[model samples]
Target: MGGPSGASGTAAAPERRSGLNRVSQQRAEAEERQRIAEGRHSDPFAYLGGPHGPSRRVRIYHPEAAAVAFSEGTEVPRVAGTDFFEAPLPEALEAPYQVCWRDAGGAWHTAYDPYAFPPVLSEFDLHLYAEGRHWHAQRFLGAHCTTVDGVAGVVFSVWAPNAERVSVVGDFNRWDGRRHPMRLRLEAGVWELFIPGVEPGALYKFELRGAGGCGPLLKTDPCGRRYQHRPETAAVVEPPEAYPWGDDAWMERRRREGSAWQQAPWSIYEVHLGSWQRDVGGGFLDYRTLAHELVDYVQRTGFTHIELLPITEHPLDDSWGYQATGYFAPTSRFGEPDAFRYFVDYCHRHGIGVILDWVPAHFPRDAWALARFDGTPLYEHADPRQGEHRDWGTLIFNFGRNEVRSFLLSSALYWLEAYHLDGLRVDAVASMLYLNYSREDGDWVPNIHGGNENLEAIAFLREVNTVTHGEQPGTCIIAEESTSWPQVTRPTYLGGLGFTMKWNMGWMHDTLTYLGEDPVHRRYHHDQLTFGLLYAFTENFVLPFSHDEVVHGKGSLLDRMPGDDWQRLANLRLLYAYQFTYPGKKLLFMGCEIGQRSEWDADATVDWAALSDPRHAGVQRLVSDLNALYRGVPALHRYDFAEAGFAWVDCHDAEQSVLSYLRRGDAGEQALVVLNFTPVPRHGHRLGVPAPGRWTERMNTDSAYYGGSDLGNAGGVLAEPVPWSGYPYSVTLTLPPLAGLVLVGEGA
Candidate 1:
């Protein structure tokens, strides 16, 4: 019996091995047959036609098409379905006909052999539905790429159930819609393409051919944080990874200092690199120059962080980068993508964390790229009613698709991983969160009664936060949300869209309005300054003088002060002091530190010369000293979220226009902040203190360095203790009019 069993086992093993070999051979033959049938178009890597050089991959949209070659700088002869025949690199023409194809409409398109030109997809539109089956009875949906080619390359997919045909068009095919038709794939109603040669810098869109010729152009990545124009758009740069980064050492040192971004007291200096300091000859400054000059300026300014506006490419000359076209490419106007990488690397090298201003709210309407890509609304909402953003005249994205979600999440990761950005300040959070936020009732669809929250967008935001914070520990995500959305700074897993911080829009509006008012009127608006404490616990906050408040006719912060030049200076000084000592993080506009007298204009450079004036000198001094004081006081920087960090000492002296508060910690560390809004100095004023013995004026807004009179008492005394009052001590002090005082107690 044993001998029979062994024989049977040996025979079975041989039979099994033979069967496996046959299966493998059949599979190989099948694959080869499929390749021939597909006409080598599907395998972009094979059949290289250009001169023997570096064996690089190329993407040919139609391999079945023929090529009509022409001389250098000359247009090719028009064939039946030929859009254009060209090579990605000029040198590839030496041995042409390497890679060629016929597009979906039988258009002849060709590229060089190994290094074929990257296919460009553009002009995408989207149509969303409340349900999959209905057309006229459905709601418009926004579209965005959630993933790209399994890895992430700005995946271009859309949902348009009503449309009969869809094609992506843009600079890839010279905006020829017929040359690059998107193939509809799967039961999920997604159109897909795996154009391997396409890399960052290629401008593209989708073309949707339905009942009519084609619909309007749409912005594919409406909320893309970075973008450039098409045709004339920034080149698709394959950046060589090379940099002798001193930042790893810096990051390690910072970690040793417990200086992971979360541990530091964030005082951000918001900057627009293009206009912050432009070249005198009418061109933008290069990244290296900006790194040297701008980085130095931020470091000297005593800010802990630098928050940059969108460095992404946009089409218009003066667009604040609100209308993005190239989602992955950095603006060529500022230099190449690697140059931007160098700039961020420099910031990290200097012990400074960089925060990028990201906009994923809406996209601009540009026909050459993104808009109506695939000849349909594949990257945006198809229904004009839902896909369009009326206020900005841009296209809104559909965030409901898994691919779209992956696309955005990957973008956030790209910045963090590639650029080493410490954080992201999401712009237009309010707009992204609501479907009918800025739209009229008839123009928008409500999720529920009186509710317009874009549920898909909310989901996107939640995913973004989850993926970003989860992947990069200690990296912050701040929201520029103006609406009173509950728990904007809460964690995503807890039923809230996680953000480390939210801009204190209430504080900014209240403070600006109050500061703009006359002294007599400020008494009534004191609550405006103090009312923020009521909701401080909801989220971490930042006091910002961002680009928004200084644009248009709003005027500069200095211009908004309520008095003459001197009083204006003093008011500004007082305001700055208050901002630093306020119970949250702080951010200042580029020129506000040195007191730029005019409103911000994207086309103009900041008034760097304003620092020469003594009036403005005071503002600069106060800013520098405030930075020092903020760093010195543990109470100011420790546990900002705790209630124990802030306490109202006095709000009763409305007639005298005085307010006092204390920022303290559990370790007997305390800072007393006093403000006098009146125009005249008050001598021997009684000020309340939590614990008083001998109080020394650590910082005075009216100090000589700050270009103010030395009317402040150098050393003040706090003698009386009142049990009836909540404070443990009180002081009789001299308060200067239109000035602020920061007094620290003698050791313990």
Candidate 2:
């Protein structure tokens, strides 16, 4: 064996060189090998299974597999030093076939081939999605069950245009992203994949690699209809709209009376579902149970609609669903998504509309949520000045992005179409319309024209309003815009925001401040009580004493009054009377009626035991009667946004701490509302009436039935021929201390 060079091993050099070449080839294949190992491959479908040399070739990636076999009489060869098992077929493979794996235990297993399916999303959907016109984007993007090529599976899709790669990782594949890298649809920047053997109730998450150098992001589906209980961030797969709706008659009525919502009585009872009477065990009440309990209460209490605080899925209990992570899902804290559907259905069946509080201004920047979604500010702006909400520690949406606008727009329509919601009370609308909202100098960025107005957000709002109203004829879109935005309730054709109504925030702030003052000092702020009527019909307004007035150390509505216990209750009664008789829609928070003494705590339930006290019970009774009277009397709600409906009888009585007004409705219906702020009843207080013979005392805040001093007005008052307050006829009556009274003409 020795050569002429004295056995220097030169004779076996060719074999050594050949081994070195194989090592070099294997080293280059390591990237292809490691991608299969780590699940970060961009195009898994293209490489995993494809046509090789005019015949079909397949790769089965199972690290634990001992041997791999196809059902079509083809045996796959396992690659040495890798988990991949590959095979070259003599003919093309028919889909819906099975793959058998013999694991280390020597037992055989079978499952359908995941690669046998076609694309779940169509190309036309991509075109609409790119233009921000896909109102039903939720139906296409979220996880859905379908059959492709005779193979039944779950199709997973998401919009992650800026991601390098996205994968569906879950318990089925041992949380491995490399196992199911989704195929990217480049036109819409959406990634989708169909996996066989995945069924409903499976927990899943997206494992996404960002376009730049950054860590991967694990996120819940934004359009997920259901989620696991909190502290578990995985999205639960479920079929949509499985609940059988029983509101056909209600929907038919809405179609027939298309414009009834505009002229109807809208006394909304705003409630926080978590804190509004919890279960006996101190847990949250199920949506189904609340459907029955809340429905009966709203029906009996005479509230036309129940406006719920945001029920969208959120991580923290303290946020009360405002910092929502799941825009489409109903929080599982109460019940399943179907249960929430039942809640809406029950409201509709019983003649009560449900208005959900929708928040699109900003979202919490939790690691598992939409913040830096693709690890590169995909959902938000890259600049902190434009994206971050410093006040709330949240992230503002980049409305300039078409996909982002489409996402939010789709959410608004989804509720009205899927859940049958009558309206959406868009929360914090002022924050959305202003680029400098709650910001100091140099802390925010200006728009394209260097102004404070968020132009893109304005355009988005117009689009949402136009589409929602166009699609749903009778649907209402109320805006909780605290600022005096111009023409919020006007149509978009007139260059307005096109809202159904805007909350009268100035009225709420001024009146609450005035009520908090001592009665002796109330005379100085008499203008505060009368200033709202100056521009009362500026926009279709809603006089709301909402949850914001009773939280965050502001104190409860009853606690806001500056008086002794009796005076406080009396002031609250008078306040309620004025609100009901005011010329606008009405919304009252839950505990305001029963007089909850403390600020609202989202964690705790209402103090139901307070009802044992007669004072609290009386306030509750008064609210019920107010709603009933407001509904039965046309003068209270008819032509609420018109100038002819109201007139100031006396706006300059600051010395006496008194104000009086007259309201007129269609059909010559009329009423007089008078209020005395001080705790001093006035005997024979003369006020003018339009044309009166006998005036029946409709409601008195000082009635003995409402825990007030039964002051001196005996049921009715007759007008005298004496001229008073610039009118031909005047009614002389007693005005109760710290009270409001409404009187209707018996014969005008």
Best prediction by TM-score? 2
| The 10-residue segment with the lowest total lDDT in model 2 | 49-58
lDDT of 2 by residue, 428-516 (tens): 99999999999899998888899999999999998999999889878889999998889999999999998888999999999999999
What is candidate 1's lDDT per residue for 704-723, written digit by digit as tens? 77888778886666657853
The alpha-carbon deviation from the true structure for residue 339 of candidate 2, after best TM-score superposition, in angstroms, is 0.4
Error of 2 at 708 (Å): 0.5
Number of clashing pairs per prediction, in order: 75, 1
